[model samples]
Target chain A: MAIQDIRNYTGQITQENPQIRIRLNEELHPRWAHCDMISRYLGHLTGTLDLEKLEKSEVAELGDSVNYVANELLENAIKERSGGSIEICSGAKGHTVTLVVSNRIEAAKSEKFKASLQKLFDGESSLEEKFFATMEHNEAHPEAKVSGLGFLTMMIHHGADLSWRFESGEPAHPGRVSVSARLTASVF
Target chain B: MNEGNHSTAGPETDPVVSGPEYLVRFSRATGTVTFGGTLRLNSYDEIKSMVRAAVEAIGPTGVLTLDVRQLKLLNSSGINLFAGVALSARSSGTKLRLMTSSEYSWQSKMLGTLRKLMPTIEGA
Candidate 1:
């Protein structure tokens, strides 16, 4: 699915009201490529995306952070379903942010997929784990065209927290495997 | 020779000027041209120009050794540029070898992938 179509799910409010909400819905398989594209698309759609709109150093930091988180989130989706679609609902309240990136995983792929997400989260909890994870590949998505680093970049470097829910029955609101994240500005 | 006939020499791999590598007259005798420097997104444009120039001068029958010892990082955009170089060599039937020390960032890993994607040259 296209990001534009996904936007219909969350009803975006990029215009700095009290929060920033972005919804991305897409299919599986291209795991890394989709995350990279959607991330960039949101980056463009939100033009100067951030509460403060960022300066030189801050913008650089933001880009790297988002890239990492993107990798983590994408890997989480691709571990299961070969052709399942994903929907990511992202929202930010002040310095705190939330992104829900979910995909349409089948019953057969649900368990393994959830396990992968949990594993990624446990690894991300520690600094060393996050560091190593960023450099390594997701064994699950072995045939992937690109190195899987989008989610790691976002979480490890960008201050985003990863979370997801895989529901196989009734496929939940048609077709979408949802994976989401919550990001907050760094304290320092 | 025929000034690079289409049936002969393929899509151009940019040429590497020698002045930057110490005025070593870049003639048909050079055989292979090696570059040493950064390969960030910004430097990719200059590198491409140099590569195409080198490939053109090196001709289809010759070989080019890309010394990546100095190339530390490459952004996604830079990766595409590098891929194009490899593709050009493949389509044109020229030989391109990339040599890098162990100190490559995650970006450089894309080089290995590019090499794998195209079986024409070598080293992925």
Candidate 2:
């Protein structure tokens, strides 16, 4: 769905509010091309928002962080979804831009994803260290594409706060995951 | 973005994996490579191989300058790939320099961290 339509669902927030959401159903099956389009659109939108609210000097950094975080979140959602749609949301509160990307995943993979997130929280290794470790691991196993570095990048490289929520399966919806990331960028 | 354009003439895999998301150009004479477009996890191996090859080509006491003003989006894996390249260059006694533009917010933010990782490297 278009971002404008999602905005309607989100209700009428003040223009000063930096948050916005875009949702796509499974029928869209947004391929990589679609992902590129959506990312670019959000990047531009977020960049404009930042420019309007923050100093001109901070625009580049803000734009880059939101775009990078949004793209990675969308990529993961599409990769994990078995057969469902995805939702992407973004907004700024104070000096941080909060972004959320969610989708329905396979029941089997939810545990694995959850375990990885837990590792991020409990593991002693730093985000930078974990990033390198994953890089090395990926070399030996070339087939693996999801190296679990998306959240780390947001946290360490891009200076973004990250979180996730996995909803329990219900009669209507099963295996839903919402991944959220927040970055310290003044949009208001 | 052209796929399968990696040249095998260098010591390692071609560092410039030009694809739909991004384009990489290496100037052998200037020891510089320019990157443009989106870089994701799938491009990680190709980039690593390319950096390795570049370092080997430059050898010890050589310099490799990276121009990333045009590279719009780079995922975490791509960041890791560049880190690997920087570390590899540092260990091999090669100097790495990055040229970035203030016009692009991501480059200014990211390249700064990368320069910190490779302290010996230069550029904004």
State which candidate has the highest DockQ.
2
* Model 1 stretches with alpha carbons more than 4 Å out: A1-34, A45-56, A71-85, A120-153, A170-176, B1-124
Q: For candidate 2, write residues A54-78 as lDDT tens digits.
A: 7754665676677777788887876
Top model by TM-score, which number? 2
Q: How much native contact recovery, as a fraction, does model 1 achieve? A: 0.00
Q: Rate the local accuracy (lDDT) of all candidates.
A: 0.46, 0.68
DockQ, Cα level, model 1: 0.05
User: Residue A9, candidate 1: how far off, in angstroms?
Assistant: 20
Q: Estimate the TM-score of every prediction.
A: 0.43, 0.78
Give model 1's TM-score for chain A to 2 decimal places.
0.55
Candidate 2 Cα lDDT to native: 0.68
> What are the C-alpha RMSDs, in order, of all predicted structures?
12.5, 6.2
